[model samples]
Target chain A: MPKMPEGTVMQRLAQLLFFSALMVFAGYFSDSPAYQLLESGQTELKLVVRHSGNIIGECRALDTGEIAALAPNMRRPMVCPREKAPMRVELDLNNKREFTETITPSGLHDDGVLALFRKFTLDSGDLILHLRITENPDAGGLPRDYEKQFQVDAHSTLIVEYTDSGFSSWQPQHSPRPRL
Target chain B: MKVEAFLDRFFPAGSNPLYQLGAVSFFLFWIIAVTGLYLFIFFETSITGAYQSVESITHEQFYIGGIMRSLHRYASALLALSVTIHLIKELGMKRFQGPRWFSWVSGVPLIWLLFASSLGGYWLVWDEKAQYIALTTAALFDYLPIVVEPMAFGFLDGTTVSDRFFSLLIFLHVGLPLALLLGMFIHIQRISNSSTFPARGLALSLLGAMVVLSVVKPALSLGPADLNRPVQTVQVDWFYMNVFPLISETGAGAAWVILLGITIALLLVPLIFRGVPKPIAIVDPDYCNGCSWCFADCPYDAIYMKPHEKLANHLQSVVVADKCVGCGICAGACPTATPFKSVNNAYSGINLADENNAAILVRTQEQIRQHPQADKHVLVVGCAHGPQIDQLASDVVTPLTLECVGQLPPSYLDYLCRKEGVDSVLLTGCAPGNCFHRLGVELQEARLAHEREPHLRFKDVHVKVTTLWAGAGGETTVARAVAQLQQDERIADAKDA
Candidate 1:
């Protein structure tokens, strides 16, 4: 059972004031006193891997009897593997391996592109970065490697994007302290 | 719970925030929707124009569009606070158990929806904070098994993201709330006469407070999001973006575990607090003439009318046992529960499996007959959920406690006053605005006022029926009301003399 209160005019006004004060206070700080999203003191290295490795097998012309053996729709003059070769990627800083991954192509037949995006925190200093990609190992495609050196600072971002043809790198400066 | 009771001293008349948390949240949603609509009028849903557009709204159009933007953000924060607190309060009260599990479970998805919508809203700004949110959210999703292509590829900063992606973000940010509104509608589906909006004054006060807060501290965006330049320290709205730091510093994998873990735990709340199930209402089809009163009165939507097996072409009330909380409001609505039934051991059309009105009537008859003789015989019928009333039983008054006062049929008053010669009946139950069974107090009040079915046949009874509702600590209040009732009856008798 609830005891009914007198609910005087003074009490109502006092409550309204109290509620308004509380609401305003909560509403203000609810999103106010905005905080930093991440602490400073480390550089962010984002390695974006986007590539379509070489096809698994070389295409070869069919012999006359082999061509006749194929079904009508499949009777193309040449035969090739439908799948792409797996790609292996590695990253090293100052000759020490920082990350390594073996990425498989997408799709049921594994005939699509290989992509792996990752971010690694690095200490702020001048250092060498080594990126290596090995594709079509079974089909004799040689490994490709690239290296760069830079004087990095806290909160700097070094994006290393790789493609089938080659690599592109960019180092964007960080805001002085923190941006609001 | 004690904190809520402390509010009675100030907000007792009409403005209890704790009582109106759900309704207050509805009010805040309305604020968000209206302000969001206003902001959308000037918003350009493109990545290039997104950040600049919001900046223009904040600085260029400071009065109209600017204030609307601030209100939108602030109201959302308030909504999150309101919703989280509401969940906590309901959990403390263990409202997730029993038939209420449906409501509790339905609300679980709404939390996720709220988070998703807020996340999308942040992305639309295309600021540094947006960059942080988009990347972290993408990283979290990338860990899930469903991602064939990495989800984070589209969010690799300025070079990869497309304008069309902004279109999608705006669509979800604007559209997901529609799903939330639908979920909210479903949440209160089982409850009858629900007030989604709060009292007018409270609504205005809350809106006024938000308006003031918006003017006090307008929301602003951080530097434009740069992918090449990774997000460092950026000011974040703590309410919506509390986990961004964790996602940024502790790894997305850890954040994934905690978020999913909390959601799973919330979903299992009812099971965690599951108590012995309450007895469900049972129907006696033979006595039921398909009146449909019980079907109409059931608060949980636990009763449905089906074709009577015994009576030709007549509808009979059937109870859905799983949904029934056994409040017995349906039994009170049953015409067969009328005290006028002459048949020995007669059953009501619908009744709690363990107790019936006939049994209550027999007990009440014995109590009234055994009471000490006096000029006036007053009986107090209360419920188990309300204040202790056994102390009120003495020479002048008799007390009868039922599972719920609503289980007492309206005509029971007529029976006590006419056949049993009781002077008056005072019906009591859970507090005025709060009923453990949701609709018990309201339904009982309606039946007494002759507004609903099973109306009291008080014409020839000459009995005074009064009602006073109090909660667990309200014994003093009930005693005062009882004393007032005695004084009123004596004065009436003196005037008649």
Candidate 2:
């Protein structure tokens, strides 16, 4: 190996000091000064839609001529369209509308569930929250509505998810956050 | 560039931290892996037990456990530093241009993996910092259309963040780095004989620094994770978690845009700054004789052996132009590149088309005749990337700069000694460990020592030749060596009188 001029002794000492200082400083300030991720009293609101919208077209009886056009194994008395209807969702707080959206179902045949998500920021304390979700919007969908009066700033974040029974509300986090 | 020179002054070339940035990063990864394994021995991969288990290890077995944790985190930070610097330095040097674009493009994903793997390890701690990482990471991921269900839904409450979540975290923290290691391996696939380990002394110094830091101040967490309360202000490792703050400031959508935008820009940088591609090495079937010496010595794997085109049944070296960097190290490795009348085959089997090896010897002979009156004429051969060789010209010293020192075949050095007016030959290129052409110094030294192929076949070769690691701080060294050669010649003349 070709020996370099400065490395045998001086280089090692310098490496020790220089890298020691570098690692020291990096490890020191890696997590310092603290980051302000969110304000103490700021509230985050989210709307989640997991329920799939109903199928769009109703099944209709097929005539003898229509059945003749289909393949032997595929022939049936009635045929229902695989595509599902899109859903409409609207949110109102204290009678004032906050959000409204008509979300379409996913998948090739539009048979997938309506996976909708929306986020908003609102203030805390005594308020009325209303969330309305429509099962199917394309076919004059029925609107399911729920309303509740609660402290908006009860926790830093709040979520209203769609379930089978009705709209459910609670402090989603483990402990209720203290209002500043 | 001066910073690089200053570092070379204190650190040398092969062992310098700047030059070994890539290798040092690999070394740091090994340190993180070992320490991670030791921590896993005592870790519990469950939500309820994870934090408690880590705390116990930190306090009860603080000596081994705490130090390992500290080493794991610190080494990871160092790895990030080294990798980032390595990428920037290579970018500045335009090492990503031409045939090197593959290595450059392949490196883009390594940054993503570095962040992903480090962030995953934070989640394993189940601390406030982990909560922050998980929340921010999910926020960024949730914006993508592929994820129909929001990822933050699981961490919404006490019941949602399950044991399975911790299991996934452990898998990611372990699996992602293994993937990164594989990616690092792929990044060097084009360059043959790439070293993942730095020099012994350098690696030892790096390890020593990490150990000392771990001893001074061990790593600590920001308390257990509590989803019920908001973590307003938290301490986060700036290296891996920098994207989090951006996600917080700019909504997840914009953050995705910025992140992906930067990544795409990096992947396209080579094309943006690409210069006219240098010519690649070309092979001559007539002089090749299928020796395979160049094929074995090519750093970029650009040379291959195939059947000769015109010959009835013989093999010859072939150049894969797409993979060649035109460094001319292959020319130096060619056995046919000799200056002797019997072995005089100036055009080697595999040599850089841009450089005429035949003219190099003629130039040397002409330069030697210019200094015929000088009693001790030293022919100083230098690399283009090496010291400022043009400045070393004088009455007694004749300087010759090649595209690389490797472009000058060993036979040229041998031939210079037997020339009428030339007293001695001095060969210098990149530093001992740092060769712009990767293997120039090693191959040249090997050939001179008669260890590798195409040996310098001249009697008393050592007396006639002087090889030095004359790079950045090497001009003085080269000049001093020339003066010494003259001084030795004078002493010999006196003894003869």
Candidate 3:
């Protein structure tokens, strides 16, 4: 309930003016061409891998006797790796190769513990995308090779994978954005 | 001079715009929230429609939708700036120490929450920059133990981004702000009389400025996101996106480490450094009537009213020891703390430690005796901070300094100017709008003006009040006022002769 002293009302007015000026300064200074550029839209495409097949080592049949010797009452899985395999991935957009990269498996040099991490961005639109991935590389080259094609739009992300049945692609559907 | 003092010169304490940064942030949040709701009405969450929907809102409804969109964006940026400045000011003033730890600790997470919410907002646009923010934020999240799947995978090659994912994004954009509001509430819970809204004039001016900015330069979205092309350069809002560049330079994992490290360090600060220690207010149940005056006046919510069995008053005063900042304003508000009142116990009501309590009275007495026989006997009451009235070379005035001008009961004004035979009372303290104790000068002013409780009873006595808004230069202003008062008194005496 305390009243402001003499001249305080004027002081408060001056403070408001100062702050309004600051807001004006900040807004104009920040809303430059660069900010305008950020505000506008652009075409972009992002690609990522979920379970990359780029193997780091050779995938070989597991020996049940060897697994049993290592651990009692143990059964060996069908797929085992002597070494980690290198996952080689290639991307072609509009029939033009835009990116190619190799990812190594995560665990052990690849006793079949394949862990591949790969991400890349490309142009967006109604474009054809040719993706190829090799699970394991032999002495000659990648023996497990998979390929697929996709048509995508701007601002879209495509997940490419090399699976047991060959290459596959999936584009997740977006939910309706909630309105107030 | 410290930045506080420099800024205080322009923004005095009684009611300054700078004093309302917290309130301004709250105001900006409301603005952002309301505008965001409007923008959301026409927004699309799908990767395909998100861009089109925002564009429609922009070009299709330029006058309303476009302006609202721009306001949402700009107000959000302003909110960030307001909060950062608020944090820095709190740090610079060392308000983060001591019992203020709750607010400081609570505030650290609010910043991250704000950033997270902002990122969600960007993603809703589904533009190139939104894409960039989405990818980087997912990459950053992937570094944490909680992330089982790299959220970045959702946007890869347009294959995994789903309606459910976009729904989560929308939820984040909406939900996190609510969380931030809750955090803000907790941040101010321990403080009494916290302003959740800025002054009406200040609020209106801020709204006007934002509207002008929105009309002048509307917010635009970056080009639609195309995963085939990497984001190169775009206009970035430095407030929310400053750390993005740092993340780009240092990699997501390193960025996470750096940010987490800083947050942890700041949270630990209140624990590591204790602020200056002071005596806590002691409550005397015998003398306390539980009138709640002290409870109402305590700037810090340190005192509480508790049920008392013996006294006729059902509730008595209790001081939460750690929460008390020992400003002694509570003592000043307590009726029993007045020295002039006859009390059964000297340690009655809420009192500071004896030494400090006795010192206040002794100091006032000694200072008043300095110029008793002067041509015009004058008592100058000022705050412990700002220009020191005691240091002034004036024969006509005696200066009494209090921890805060508000810490002196209204009765003191009557006792000094009337009973003590002083011709005039000159009240001075921090400049307009800048009381060190927040409401010290304000409370004192109201008491002297008889607008509040504990009114200054001697209405006929001459009492002059001035704010030392100029810091050190306030000394001259005080001296000149004293000389003028003396001269005015001499003239009146001569007329009587």
Candidate 4:
């Protein structure tokens, strides 16, 4: 067997030691308590909506000439809404409601845009999430409402969004951010 | 400097036994498997029992449980580290090129399989890290079009948590490792005598280190997972869980893109800058003496001895062309491969086609002997893959380049020193363990030592012989050795006077 220089061997051993030490430091010692807590097992579900539902009985198609008559810079939405709806969310586990919230639509706003946002701490198990939005509850016999059910497990965040097509769900496929 | 040179400097002979990163990974896997099996025996897979079972293992069975847990975790982290190193080392050494694509390609999926196994193992613990992984993995799965409902629903509230879900986690924890083991087997299928384990000393040292780390800071859980409340604090094993943070920064789509892009890039690397394929070794039955020397020395297991009724010797060596790496080690191993001798139709039983032949060796030796210098005349034989032999001062030394130094039979050294009247011979090759042909340098060492068959006879030869591990950067070392041989020869002549 060819002999390796002793100095070179010692130098390499030092390098290996340094690398292992670096990994150990990064794994255990590189975080604050608060930041570590956020990354722990805590499951925070953040829900935000950017748009209100746009459900129309019928939408009229506008010609280019009609748009020119209005003004070059003026823009009109293609869909016409009868009434804006208040959003309601209910969290059910084993057929029992754990959380329920009613988000009323804005009365004075022309678009009746009601921005809904909520955060919840979910337990571990099967969960049924029911979402309903009524444009105008008093205008008709029953409220003009759209409802959908979502099921979520523990340590997960489910984002329920109100879009033009009713409720679109978004859940982070990863844990919460590093709050630290 | 070449990557081989860098490795040679660090892992000197015997100290770097089976130091290939892939083999290190295999050793780490064994450690994890053994420790994991010990831990699993005491583990409870039920949702309610999972946390308590682990706590019992840690608190009640502190010595065994704590140590095992730490070993499992550290070994897992080390496995991940070693696999990454293996990938980088192969990339640097150009081991992914040409016919060597199978191992490289299979290795990509093998990494994912390993990750999946580790992820499942974490989830089985049902600790804070397990909870985090479960939730994060669930969310990530929900992002895919294949998942209709968030798998996270099962973990949402304790009311919905069931033994079946816990069983699934346990199943995956067990199943993924089995799959990883299978994938590993496939990864090295194309390689002959592929070392899947590190040396005993290195393995024991690594095991000892992990054990010490375990005892020093036993792998503690981040408290038991509470479904009603979020976990307050925990230390993350960034090695396996780093992807979650990445997914946190970039949405799952982009994360998938980054992952898939890296995988695709790795898979396609062999196709880029591919060199022209070398011809495989072929067997000539008529010349084969059924010595089985080639069969024993073939690095790729491409040769086998078979019984043939037609020949004077019933056993003849055969070359499996598909498996042959065309390293030409077999041709050098054959006793009948004295291609330089003035014989009719000189050839070896198993020889590489076109790339290396007996004719080339005979021709090259003839050219080297064309010089008229009689005293202190030396022949410097070196590997083509290493430093070029031609770069030596050609006045005193004639250069002979072989595909690898191992491909030159020990008799070739005898022929040069005895018949060719060369005063001395200096043989140099790539440093040991860094042989591009895997076992070339090792075989050469064994042959020169006369510890193996087809040994060179040193009868009537008083020529000074030296072997050097002069890689591409070792030209100065080779030159110095040659000059010393000449100096010694001159001293011998003066003593005679």
Candidate 5:
């Protein structure tokens, strides 16, 4: 047989080596984090809501350390004081709705609007709140209105009613409104 | 005229032994597959589990699983070796040129598949090498697009990427082998009468070798893979991984592209060059005996026994041209030497000068005889077998003394045909199962059909020119065979003749 062309064997050998290395690397060293998360059980969830063109009213339980709200302008911040007892925030979106339960804290904590939003697990939906304003009629008025509903689908939001006192027919601010 | 010559060239009358080797190698692949499937059921594809599974086969399941693994590995290595050798032999013999080019072209992808399959086999271990390989592959993919989940803080959730990484590896391990099997099938479609199985002895011997090797140097994993530790050095199978170092230099994608380009070029080589018209062996109507040696001996199912209408002397004869690789085993099988000469039989009846014919034939034969002192020069005089004569001459140092100025050989002539300094012999006899000596030719043909060489057949070496004829009564048959042999200018005229 003709002497194999010069370097032909070597070239073939090199190719085999390269591909083999690639396969090996792909199999063993693939360090994807998603898998690690699934393995480690250290899952963290973060939620951010911004309203561009509307007035919004929102309430949150600051004690639970759940949600955080960031206003377009950082100058005004509201912290919802921890309630004496565990409280729930019900959100109604489009038509469907869900509620989040939060516990009150013992020590003094940030009562800002941002802190209150973080306290509860608000299901994605619209917000229709019925609350008993304890201190002021319009004190740190309800959280700004967001066009988009929190619930996964439209017409869904939180509908809150203050149960401390007999149910009152308070005009709904329809804060955190569903946006297109 | 060019078209006719082209048609006649590729469709030459004879069989190629390389084609036979390819056939046998194909069967070997199937053997590998059946065995591989058995092993795959037991194999653990995971990094941590793979090595242990393989070890279990060797330690616990030695009788069945171990044997299967050994067979699979051996078959893989053998398949690669056989294909490479087949390619080299064809190239050296210049058989890859002409109509046989597509086979050569398709061969490149086949080589790639072999490598892919072998590499995937490596990963099944998930050893240190596998770990290193995994990291390297991930790095390669990192260069591609990385989609961002704005809700998430990081550019990539490392966890997601890692999950995909494992999925991809698993997919390749399972999928590539199937593809390789498909490629093997396509590689042999063009050639006829190719053997799918190696000789039983040869198969057994190959399996034996694999067993010995596996026992002596069992495939071992290089410890558990550590992502933090860099693999500085590792034992590499040069046959499969010679290009790894190049990857370090040129970068992976560039190396990959260059290698792919080279493979494509190698595969398409047959289309890049041309060769002499494929010579077809033709038979003289008068000399045939209706015997059937060529039909039995033809490696490529090129020859067939057909009833003779014109000649009363012969009952049935072999007819083949398009499927022939012109190996000439058929011509060598002819008893009456009815199919004489390598070129068109019509070329012999052109009535060239008598003295010229004598001088050329005698001179060519004499040169062959004299060349024994330098190196065994064997003059294989035949018509349809001419191309093979050229092939043998180019490969073996022996001078091929040809004689187109001739007739088919009788039984006595077969015994008389001999050359000095010849280490081996080859004759392109007429198509198998169709000779004149009432089985005499077939018997002689049997002697030439041994499978002595793994990459070559003795039948291929000893050939017959089963198509070209020298006309009636065998008067000018010898002269025509002699004339066909003289086409090679390398032969010097003998002073005595």
Candidate 6:
């Protein structure tokens, strides 16, 4: 059996070291924002309002955009003059349970608009949104439609779900009594 | 009894352990290469990161990365085994004597390269063993006058040596394997025809073993490499790292000198040791028929087909001289008793009469076509790939015949190229792994590509040289392959054209 040259072993040892270093460098260089995002556990969420009914007002958890619970018999009312078009709202959330929602509405106005009231509840780690829309027959317009259920949490924050379809618009009706 | 007849009686087709072993080794190398590539991606070369990275890959990516690494390592080890076995089989059989001395001499370097490539791969892990290897290896280099300065200063001045030394080592790790690939090319260059794929069992077993090992062990790192901390105990790969301790104890400088001397001595063995020149195997053009069985059978890939337009046989016949490794596989494969005598017939007393008589029986055109013993009508004509042949034969009730497609006599080939009832004459020879025979399947294809010969001009001949792996008992595989080729209208058209 022929033996390998002595230098061959040394050369091989050197090669091994070199390749290991190169791989390390490659791994280190692969640090990008996208990679960081995945590593840090950041997620995105979209909220969409349904067109079936008017959305008077909504609240959400400041953190994680989750809906917060509402007090029993208490409601936040929002006014909508017309319901021909849709409305979109964007919100941001943090780790804390606090959240805020911003809504942008654009459409034609109708006299007989529906009033929307929504409440959020959180129980057993589940967020449930309760919605009540009131339509006025005294007005000349047709009755409002309530197509899908709205979800909320314990904090009574309105939960909006986003889909590929555009946001659903809502019209609110004026109530005779206002809680000051 | 004629020499050919005697050889035929004993060494018939599918015999020759050396040839079988050579085929086995070729496949093993491929297994090593593929696994090595997968491991290379995740390997970290730095002393600090190497072990950690390996650990992460093995623990976290065990299903993919870790398994691949283990397979690579196991395949590498197996490659060493196959190469060593091939070498021993050659020597014990006395196939390395005479004109084959160059190949024999070159074999030493090939082994050296394999070890070097394997060892380099081990060091990339940068584990405790890797560190020990690094330090001990530096010690060995300290012996060489050329490398002494770097070695001596490398230890004393950590920063100067560590980075540069490591960099140099990295260069070698990548470069050495490339060099080994070149050496492999050169090693088989002298042989007229040789195969890269080993026998079916050997190739599949090697691949299967690698897969199994990867799944079982899944290579992992030992620990983060620390230059300061001494690795008291390290797992040693004795195959390549055995000489490290020798250098550590004997002083690096001394070890280098001694090792250099030994290498020079081994390289010069063929020159120093004299032996009478042995006659290599010769080809007889008259009976050759250009079937290229010898070309396919040659373990060294030494036999080639040279164009001869005027001979009794048209097209090219097997020409053996320069590339002939004297393994006599061509003699064994020649359907016609064309390889009259062993190349070293003068020294070995090979009987040509016996060889010729045996050739007359099996080499005849009638026997080649009408032999009832031929179980499989589907002749897998390709470069002699032991593994593929074994795989194809094991599954189907067909006698899987392999021959250098290049040696297919244009006349008989024209007949078989389009003949009916021959399910599919799948020409399975060298493509990516070209045979030692200069004219492998590609060359034969090239000849057929321009204009189909008159005999093959008929439409039924379904000839195809595939690159897919063919294993034993892979009938569904063979059937699928045949079906696929049969579906190819172009192949049919080409045969008819």
Q: For this target, which candidate reaches the highest DockQ against the unseen true structure? A: 2
Task: List, residue by residue over B93-208, the lDDT tens digit for candidate 5.
Answer: 46576445656777778787777777677666555565445444443433232311121111111221233443455578568877876776676665544446655543454455
Q: What lDDT score goes with residue B319 in model 2?
A: 86
On a 0 to 1 TM-score scale, where does candidate 5 land against the true structure?
0.46
lDDT digits (tens) for residues B193-271 of candidate 4? 7777776656666677777777877776665655544554555666677777666556667778888899999999989
Candidates sorted by DockQ, best first: 2, 1, 3, 4, 5, 6
* Candidates' chain A TM-scores: 0.74, 0.77, 0.54, 0.44, 0.23, 0.24
Model number with the top TM-score: 2
Tens-digit lDDT track of model 6 for B1-497 = 12212222222123222345566666666666776677567755664455566676777777887777776666565566557666654554344455566777777887778877777766776665665666566555533433313232332212323434455666787788788888877777665546566555435544654575557445555554444333445555554565666665556666667777876765665566545553356655444466555555455555567764446545454544554534343443444422223442112111122233233223433434664444334545433432244444422223334334444433334344344234445645432222333344334454445342212333334443333323222335455665575466346567889
Taking the candidates one at a time, how many backbone clashes does each contain? 4, 3, 67, 22, 149, 91
Q: Give me the displacement of residue B389 in model 6, in angstroms.
A: 30
Candidate 2 vs candidate 3: the DockQ winner is 2
Give DockQ per model, in order.
0.34, 0.34, 0.16, 0.10, 0.02, 0.00
Model 4, A134-154: lDDT tens digits are 443444424323334545555
- The TM-score that candidate 1 achieves is 0.85
Global Cα lDDT for candidate 1: 0.80
The estimated TM-scores of all candidates read 0.85, 0.87, 0.78, 0.76, 0.46, 0.44
Q: Which stretches of candidate 3 lie over 4 Å from their true place?
A: A1-20, A28-180, B1-15, B342-348, B354-359, B370-372, B375-377, B393-396, B431-433, B462-497
**DockQ of structure 5:** 0.02
Candidate 4 global lDDT: 0.68
